[model samples]
Target: MKQGIQAFISYTYTKNDVWLITMKDMMQWVKNPIENSHLTKGYWICQFNDKIKCSEQTSNSTTKKVTFAAIINVDQIWIWQTAFLVVLYIVIYRYDKYMQEKKKK
Candidate 1:
């Protein structure tokens, strides 16, 4: 029987929003100790609110094993966009109120 390596990556878009990635039985050669070492291992782009993509290769030697894990922190752009929408709603409500008052006069 042979032992396998497991790795995981977890990150938050905001204080509440979180995303996770996990790889089981991964090769040991691609292991990284950093929290968000996306560029260190290979050429890959990670986008916020997008599905994660992964690639790995194992060594020819069967004795040694390796694994890699990374967690990326994305900006809370969704939270900001929600706030802006709320402000716009308030402005529209106020405008409607002003128009109603003018028509009564």
Candidate 2:
């Protein structure tokens, strides 16, 4: 019975220790988008060790770090894209009209 119970507990409980580091924190490490290939339209999961294993005594000390575990949904992408297109069209239209007026002058 004890062995069966232990198996049941193990099956029922699973732990996934994933840490989420915001975009702001990531910017510190990677300044340019061209440099880092994983910073494109996604939610990233970063995992780091709780404590330093070695006595490096440096400002940067971590065991592990993971990034870009998930990407933004298609619906979100469509919405943002639609908004951007609308704004871009408005700007272009206004600029064109301004240019036409200047040409007349």
What TM-score against the true fold does each predicted structure earn?
0.29, 0.30
Write one digit per residue (lDDT tens) for candidate 1, span 1-105.
Answer: 322223354433224444444442112212322232331222223332322223332333332122224322235445533443443344334445545665699
For model 2, the stretches where C-alpha displacement exceeds 4 angstroms are 1-75
**Candidate 2 deviates by what RMSD?**
20.4
Q: Per-residue CA lDDT of candidate 2, range 1-105, in tens?
A: 111100000011124444444434344324433343332221222221321111112233342232222233343545434443443344335445555665699
lDDT of 2 at 32: 39
Which numbered prediction scores highest in lDDT against the true structure?
1
Candidate 1: residue 20 lDDT (0-100): 43
* Total colliding residue pairs, candidate 1: 5
Residue 76 lDDT in model 1? 42
